[model samples]
Target: MKSSAITCNNGSFFNVFDEGMSLVCDEDLQALAIAVIQTEMKAVAKLADRIDRQFVQACHLLLDCKGRVVVTGMGKSGHIAGKIAATLASTGTPAFFVHPGEASHGDLGMITRQDVVLALSNSGETEEILTILPIIKRLGVPLIAMTGNAESALAKLASVHIDVAVEQEACPLGLAPTSSTTAALVMGDALAVSLLQSKGFTRDDFALSHPGGSLGKRLLLQVSDIMHRDAEVPMVDDSVLVSKALLEMTGKKMGMTAVVDEGRRVMGIFTDGDLRRMLEKNLDVHATRVATVMTRPCTVIASDILAAEAMQIMEAKKINALLVVDENRHLLGALNMHDLLRAGIV
Candidate 1:
C-alpha cells in the first residue's frame, strides 16, 4: 500500500452520488428533447392541413355571434383557453375567460343568451367543465368543444366539435400534457386569426382597443390633433430678412419657419439646416430676403391625415418638419418629428 501510486483525471467527479446527475448532461437525453419538439411541430403542421369545412363553420359561428365568446377549460387546458379568449377579444371578436370551477359556483351568470361557450379539455371529461355544461345549456347558450377525444362526454354535448387530437404526447411518460396542449393552443389561434381576417379588422380598429400600445399612437394620432397651431407655428413674410426667419424659428422652437407670400400661401420653408448651408456660402443673412434662402415647394400635408402617414411622408421626403395646409395652400398648422414623438406618434 505504501508503494502504490494513483492518478485521477480532472474531468472525473470525486463523489459517486454526483455521477448520477450526468443523466441531465447526457447526449441521449438532449436528443430525446429534440425529438419531442420535432414530433410536436409535425403534429401542428398536420393539423394545419386539416382545416376543412369544420374550421370554416367554426369561423362562421363566431362571426355571426352577436355577443362575446365565453371560453372555459380545466387545468392546463384552461391556461391555453384563456390566451385564446384574449386573442379573440383583442382582434375584433368580443370574448372572455370563465373558469369552469367558478362557473359552477355562481359565475355562470356572466354568460348571456347571445353568448357562445367554447370549452377546452384534453380528456373532454373534466369534472369541473362537465358540471357547468347543464348550466350553459339551461342558459340557451351553444357549446363549441375542443378536445382530442371525439367520443368524449363534452364533445357529445357540444353543438359543434372541433377536434384538436394529437397523434401522441411529447412527454416520455405520456402523462404530462405536451403535444395535446400544443395542438389545442394552435387550433385556438387558428380560430382567432381566421375570425380576425373574416371581419376585416383594420389597424385603426386594433388601435382603438390598444390605445396604450405604440401601434395605437401611430394610427390614432392625427396631424391636426398633434400639430402646433397659432402662435407656436413659425412663420415669416417673403420680404422679411433671413435673420428674421432665423429668429422666428428660434422663438417658435421648431427649427423651421414657413415663408408666406402676401396671399398667405406658403411660398417656401426656411430651416436651421438650410441656414447653416447658407452661412457656409458666406451669404448675407441681414440683407437676403427670407424667400431667397427658403426651400420652395415645401412638403405639405392635410391636417386630417394620421400621424403614422406623416412619419412615412417625412421619411420619403427626407425632411423633419411638415407644413400643414388647407386645400387653398393656406397655412393651417406646422409640426416636426419632435411633436410626433411628444404625442406618442413615433
Candidate 2:
C-alpha cells in the first residue's frame, strides 16, 4: 500500500492512502479555520479605503430617492443583496430586494424614476443583472454598482461604481466567494448605517418597523400603558395609621403602598419590608402614623418614559416596584416587576 504526504501547520505530515482515505488532525482543522477568518478580515478591512467620493454619491442617491431602493443580484450575491435590503429598510431607508432574473420578466416595473437601483455582482458581469440594465437605464433611475472588476460592463454603465474587489478568495483553492461576499456585506452595512445617521434615524423609528416581538414591547410600551391607574394604585394618606396602610397593601396585593400628603403629593413609600422592620421595633400599628415608618424619598418614574427604563431603575435600586408620578410628584399610577414581566418588557 502506497501513501502520500500532506503537510500540516506543525511541520509534520499526514497520510493520504492511495485508496482515497485521509487522516486530518484537529490542529490542522483549527489552523485552516483561523486562516479563513484572517483572510475574510483582511477583505473587510480593505473596504474602508473604498469609502470615498463614489460611496458618498451612492448615499446621496439613496437618500434623495423618492421611492424605495431596489436591490438586485444573482446567486450568492442575491442572498447578500436580500440581507442588505432588509438592513436598509429596518434602519430607516425604504428598500426591498428584486431578483435580477425576475426583473427581466416584468418585475422591473418595481423600479421607477423615483427609485434607486443597487446591483451586486462579484464578477461585475452577471448575465441576469446585465439583462435588466437596459430597462433600468430607460426608467432613468440611478444605478449604483458593486463589483470586483472596476472595468466591467456593469461598472462602466453605473451612475456610481463601488469597488468591492478582494485580493483573493478565502478558500484555499480560491474557487469560492467567501472573501468577496464578506467585503460586499460589510460595505452594505457601512452604507446602511451612514444613511441611518444622515437621516437622524432613531430607536423609536426602528421600533415602528419592528412591532411584533419583545423588541417592540421594550421600545413601544410606556410606563403609563402598563401601570395600575388611580383606583388600582395602592395609596394611603400620610397621616393614616400603619394598620390602615397595611390594609391597602394587602387589598391591592402590590406588597407596597404610596403614602401621600393631604394635597395628594407623594410623601413616602411603605412596603412589606417596612412592615417587617416596624414589627421588629414592636411599634403599635394602630397608633403609629404611616409617614413615621415609611421609606422616605422613594424612587418614582414619569408616566411617559419607556417601561424598560423603569425596569432598569427598579433593578439598580434592588426594588420590585415603582410609583408613576407627574412633574408635580403627584401619584398617577404604580407598577411592579410582575407588570413588566407580563408586558414582556423584562
Q: Pick the candidate with the highest TM-score.
A: 2
lDDT of 2 by residue, 1-346 (tens): 8988887787777888878586776677789999999999999988889999999999999999999999999998999999999999999999999999998888988787899999999999999999999988888999999999999999999999999999999999999889999999999999999999999999999999999899999989999999999789999998899999989999999999999988889998999899999999999999999999999989999999999999999999999999988999999999999999999999
- Write down the TM-score for model 2: 0.92
lDDT of 1 by residue, 89-179 (tens): 9999999999999988899999999999999998899999999898888888878999898899998998888888888889978889999
Computed on alpha carbons, the lDDT of every model, listed in order, comes to: 0.88, 0.94
Model 1 is weakest, by summed lDDT over 10 consecutive residues, at 1-10
Cα misplacement distance, residue 131 of candidate 1 (Å): 1.0
Q: In model 2, what lDDT does residue 43 have?
A: 90
What is the model-wide C-alpha lDDT for candidate 1? Answer: 0.88
**Candidate 2, superposed: residue stretches over 4 Å from native:** 1-20
lDDT of 2 at 305: 96
Model 2, C-alpha of 282: deviation from truth (Å): 1.8
